[model samples]
Target: MKVHIHVSLKSGVLDPQGRAIHHALEGLGFAGVNDVRAGRLIELDVDDSVTDAQLDEMCRKLLANMVIENYRIEKVGEKENA
Candidate 1:
């Protein structure tokens, strides 16, 4: 099975990298580029027997920093199709 974890900053967190990208976009003459927030995507291939509780634990422990970030996990393969 495959696990896809998306980690993103919570609202009100300062994102300097996202700000820089926004400025760059503006410089390139792109209009209406309101705000940019950067985040991370982590993909893991694990045994088929891995449970949802275990995956949640993995995200809380390693994939996301619970203090300033939020994460959503997606299971890939047949589970996804279903």
Candidate 2:
């Protein structure tokens, strides 16, 4: 099975990289982009037997910083839930 983990900063947390990208876009004459919140997508190929609990554990323990980041696990071909 293939999984995609989307990791991003929490709502109240500041994102310097996102800000920089926004600024760069404005500099390059692109407008109407009010905000940009950057995030990451991690793709993994795991056995079909991998349980959702194990995937969540992987995010909580190693993939994401529980302090200021949030993550969503997406298993290919299935609808995702928080």
Cα RMSD of all models vs. native, in order, equals 2.8, 4.0
Top candidate (lDDT): 2
* Per-residue alpha-carbon lDDT of candidate 2 for residues 1-82, written as tens digits (9 for 90 to 100): 7899999999989999999999999999998999999998998888989999999999999999999999999887444423
Q: What is the lDDT of residue 10 in candidate 1?
A: 98
Candidate 2 regions exceeding 4 Å error are 77-82
Alpha-carbon lDDT of model 2: 0.92
The CA lDDT of each predicted structure is 0.90, 0.92
Tell me each candidate's TM-score: 0.89, 0.91
Query: Per-residue lDDT for 1-82 in model 1, tens only?
Result: 8788999999999999999999999999999988999999988889989999999999899889999999999877656633
Model 1 error, position 12 (Å): 1.0
